[model samples]
Target: MDDPIMKHNVPDTEWFDRSSLRRMLRTYSLVYIKPDVGRKGNGIIRVKRLRAEEFEISYKQTTSLRSRDKVYSAIKELLNPDKEYIIQQGIDLATYRHRPFDVRVVLQKPLGKWRTTLMCAKLAPRRSSVVTNVSKGAKDYNLYRLLKGTDQRLNRSEIIRNLIDVSKQIAQILGSHFPLKILGLDMGIDKRGNIWFIEANTKPDCQGLKKIDRRLYRKYLRAKKIMRNG
Candidate 1:
């Protein structure tokens, strides 16, 4: 329930009543509507801001709407009164060559101490989508290739430090909450060099591990074994 990435010193998001949400949507520039208990990147929507005179809406299910009233009505009609949901602020992610991308950081607690096992870059599909979850058709790029590739503003040291620091911080926070032996964190690094907590997965994909730094992985394994045997 605690998301340090939410910022604003606000408490964890709570379920808003129907009228309250409408009022909030009118006030907040952007908001996300997601299932409170959903998993595997399902049932989430990034609602765009509505101008005083113009309003538009789009989703995976319905991509086209002509009028503001229609958009509002459609959103309201899709709401599930029986289910719990959260309204979150939308984050404008950093882009790579005009295409938005996010970083997928894999963390494992093998023995006891938390360690980051792998890091991968996920490029969102050309279509407009807020999340870069693979299930949502986001393409996975080689992490090292992207990092090592030419970008005048970014240096290798900065890239590594940013990812490493954020990964460790997120692992520390989640570990404090659940005391899990292993966990995977999917994080977002924005254009302004801000780190965001997208979501955490109990079972993370290890496919990208083979492509990441071997030395780091070895250290994690060695530390995990020591803790397990201790």
Candidate 2:
């Protein structure tokens, strides 16, 4: 999923390591280091290059200002020896009321055709949190309402169309190799209105969508029924 998106619209990402971390930090200024098998944004770290040699590593409730080597070592110590990690270029995501937010594009396969069923925005509770995971104190909002007054440079309707198209594309690509029923594409929109694929979730949680819009939730249920009947 990321491979197709990366070739086109998504941000640059690579496996995390001392060498790659140093290179990506130089290239991206701000990069995210995340565990390969973590959820709810747990064990995710945000690394930012501040000066020539100074950098910052921010994890849950901890932000450390240190030199390049020290920052690397600190991250290394926090990592599990057996688990893999990834380094991703961080996009300065769009903000709603001073808090960073990201869109969740939900796509479902009904009658063997992919359809975009739901679009919800998750806003971080605080500016310090690294992710907008609903489990991490993030609040869900209606996608259209969230984009209502913030930035008007980009056309909202067009953005929504693009998001749905890309999400369906991702689902189609992933479905080729596996039996994909639904996808929850975590997407970020930059200040410039460029949409980036942050990540993809195969078994997406719909609790946020249910809380935000029951109509969309009912639609989602109908899609699931089609899947089950088929």
Best by the TM-score measure: 2
- Total backbone clashes of candidate 2, pairs 3 or more residues apart or in separate chains: 0
Model 1's C-alpha root-mean-square deviation from the true structure amounts to 3.8
lDDT of 1 by residue, 41-73 (tens): 677766675565455455564554434445556
TM-score per model over all chains: 0.76, 0.94
Name model 1 segments beyond 4 Å from true.
1-16, 19-28, 65-72, 80-82, 147-156, 208-230
Question: Which 10 consecutive residues of model 2 have the lowest summed lDDT?
Answer: 1-10
Candidate 2 structure lDDT: 0.85
For candidate 2, write residues 1-230 as lDDT tens digits. Answer: 34734466767788998898888977988899888887888889898889979988888888889897687888997787888999999998888777888998899989989988888999999977788998889988999888886643657887888888777777877788999889888999887888888888888888657878788889999999999998
- Top model by lDDT, which number? 2
* Candidate-wise lDDT, in order: 0.65, 0.85
